[model samples]
Target: MGTGAVYLTLSNLKNHPDFLTKVEIVFFCLNIILFVTNSTILLLQLVLFRQQFVRLVLDPVKGVFVPLIVLSFATIIIGIINYLVVPGHLTFEFVYVAFWIYIAFALMVCIPMLMIWFNSSHDIKTFTPAWAFLVFPLMLVGIVAINVLRVFPLLDPRAINVLLVGYIFQGLGFFVTFFYLTLYILRVMTTGFLEGHQANGAFVACGPPGFTALALIKLGEASRVILPQFGLVSETAGEVFYATAVMGSLMLLGLALFFFVFGVIPYWFKVHKHLNEILGCWALTFPNVGFVVTFRALGDVFQSQLFWTAHAVFTYSICALFVILFSLTIFAIVRGEVLFAKEKDLWADIMPEEQKRLTDNAASFGTDTVSTLDIVHLGGRKLSVDGFSEVDLEKGERRPYANI
Candidate 1:
């Protein structure tokens, strides 16, 4: 099926004039290579690290990594379909699938990252929010899959509502978690301490700005679904296309500005505070390039050279950064202790008292100091302890350090 599709894409490319087409067989060849590389890595991980993958990834209640793989596969399928079905137009089918593939690529990163984040061999049973964050992108993936497949009639109509609920909740999940991430960064910053590189990896793994940009784009699409109710526009394909394009273009612009000004710049300056700071710094590297390509849609619509040139630069730059970032992350992961120990020690510094208190308590109470407290509950409760209790106080004798 894939071979037939590739053949069709080649046939379509042959008809277009040499000057009219910027995309070549080489582009498809490169894409195939990337796909194979990612697929091979995933297969190897599932085989060699099956136990670790199950413990660190598949066993989680949220099931983030599997959803991510499903999403990536869906995006790849959709992109291949788009290339075959509508090779000329930069319309919804094309945009939808292309962005999704990039999303998959970004999330594919989290697989190995999750492995590294959960590398503590002491107790495989213990879990952390860092693990939860590692799987967050999968939530978005399930959401997008439902939305697109339903809209495109690739899925059953009865399932549409389920998909919508998935979309809404998935979106809300990202929204709620993102606030905590922001709070986390703020806490680290205010304390004049840095989080472990893995913690920073977990933060970038949450994919705040990228998800927001996608959310905004989705919101614009949702607007098109209800456009005719206002009676301000016709319910025609051309009209829908134009409106979605215009709205998406504007939202993309706003998101690009927000990403660069609010997200990228701040992150770049504070890169030292993060352990895998490069991941956070480079997370937007691909998504922002997609945003730039969205801008190039103007030329695609008009069938002109203007958009094509912009695409060339956007494609090249993003591809370069992707290669560089992937190389750096792989090196860092393999180097493990040497590369990350210094940064992991940074997280140790931030809450030294908390960690120490936990350690002391663990020795006494039989609990680790690194307990996970839900942020909401922490906000609501307030308690103060005067001092430790006496071991034997029946005669009203108090131990100095035991009770006060």
Candidate 2:
């Protein structure tokens, strides 16, 4: 999704003389390859490892990320519209149908996953801004709508419907994200920043408002064109909507900035030490892409050289961040740390013998043997070491340790 966002943002610069079409093409192909490879692996996991897949979906710490599956597809759709349909290389009719199809897929996946999270028990102290991912796909609807709207006349019925639905989606996504963010603030105030690499999740908070701002501005641009032709109210109603959208988007951009700063402060203090243990490090990429895209939108809205310069600087910064994170991810994989690490918490419910087998397999692959105590500690479970015994912090009882 992050790569696709970078590609889409660069593709939007087609009118700029310095825009390199080949760079955009490289990113487009890279995005497609990464998306397909990841999707295939996930699909295989679902098919061949159904039990483990179910466990993963129900695991408290990891389950929140399930929505990213749908969100990834949303990026693909946006990329297709912008890179293919907008260029007239692909017919609008195909992407138009794809738009609705993706909407249905996002709703079906995100809604049910949200309900699952609601029905399941979760400790509030374990909450992180990563929960914002649940609504990310829907938030992207407005972006998809704008891209789709580009191929149609401002007065076309199809464009009008897309515009109206975009507003609905934007509202749903933004307000729900607002609610989660409120809880995130409460969680942080009560529990402090999530420890270790998990602190990277804080950056996830920047994504919602950033994308919401981008969507609002783009949708507002659409309204400026479409609403005036419909005779819905005064001829200036479109202008009013556009003005209101700019104000709302600016407010959202401020909120996103707050999160971006909030996420950065921990890094400044050196709170997160394990930078490459998990793929979550990439959280730094997509969220900031939204921020940069919003900056670009404001640049376009005002034609301000300052805003455009800020946008360019940040865009290059994000590109550098992506490269750094990508290199770390590959190194971690080679070291048998991230994808190959057998996280016991994820298999806490497995049979003891099966758990041992997986643990040994991981160790055979040169992965370090991480104790259950370490895994539990990382997960923030209420357990503490008391000499040779393990004490349950919640119950204040010592239990014999089992090495498995």
Candidate 3:
């Protein structure tokens, strides 16, 4: 799209043409900035802190996002192809369609296995908002399929059948999202707000409902397109789904928005003066996109200009936010605040000392002493500790073991 816009701009003869050249420029800049920043961070992680990166990948909560990240880019590629590449070539629809099927199926299979593995193998002390990422692929297939169907050829008789298959997964995704949402609420009410960077993770809750809302709208359309043939019900099944889906989505949107504010405002005012340190702040990006798109779906459903206007406002605003976030994230990376770098090296030479800081903080609750003898790593020294120290972190600065 970027190159295409430039080509069109150069070809146009008008002095003040109202062309989409600005969009092209914006996309070009955003693409370059995000690409460079991400590449730089990944490289740094590989070279400077390979072990930490491995630990992160293996981590139960954080690890889930890795494959989800891959799936995210796959969806992005599908979008690029749909909008930028394959519009004129209906034949090429199969290429993206096949790609989507492979990815969607892979996610359907992989997510549950990972969920079982992560939940069983690891002892989860703190449940971060990353958990919501596990279920996103559920709604993802329906979203991509519905949109692509608009332009792509009706290549198969089973397009509706394929959608039915996707609907099953979407249902599964919705259930998982709802289940975890309860856990999340319990964590907040029983445990307290996720401290430090994990607090930003609250933004993740915004995705499931919003994505599901948007997906249902498309699925409703897809059902309306095909459901009449099966004699399951009338064409009104689509409207039924749309009505319930929209109402449910609006409620979820309110909750998601509340959680967004619940997550961000306190951190801004009380916890962290700025969002410079945490990569979990990236949680702000995808979920907001989900909401923005869902709102657009609502506009289509009600045919209301207000919802369309809201969608347009949020779309640009979020893009602007993402761009600003990209800039800050890059700055954070350069400052070495994002890297847990402990040594001085040639590559690390440019990291400014003043800007070096910690970005992530895991909130802690009290732990039980399972045994009298425990091995502890403290200050790079191995200590055989005989007993545990019990202190109310919220209540007292003085530890009972302080004198001992």
Q: Give the best candidate by TM-score.
A: 2
lDDT of 2 by residue, 1-404 (tens): 66776676665541455456678777878888887898898798778667677877877777778888777777788777766776789887887788788799889988887887788777888788887787888888887787788776677678778889989998898889889899889998998866666677888888888888988888888888888788766889888888998998889889999988888887645345463455877777876667778888898888887778877777777777778877877888887767753555454444567446534544543445544445465564324343454444333345676731
The backbone clash count of each candidate, in order, is 4, 0, 1
lDDT of 1 by residue, 1-404 (tens): 12112222232331346642334344445556656776787687567646444553545433433444443443344445445435554444553554356455645666665565446442322222244445455445533443354345323342333334445545665665555455545544555333333223322323444444444444344434533434334666335644664565555455445534444333444446422455443443433433454434444455767655655555555556555666776766775722343433333233446545543543353322332132113331111122553211112233444333
Task: Give per-residue CA lDDT, model 3, range 304-342, as digits (tens).
Answer: 778777766665555566667768777887877775554
Instruction: Quote the lDDT for 318 in model 3.
Output: 59
Ranking by TM-score: 2, 3, 1
* Model 2 alpha-carbon miss at residue 175, Å: 0.4
lDDT per prediction? 0.44, 0.75, 0.57
Model 2 lDDT, residue 287, Cα: 67
Error at 163, model 3, angstroms: 1.5
Q: Pick the candidate with the highest lDDT.
A: 2
Span of ten consecutive residues with least summed lDDT in model 2: 380-389
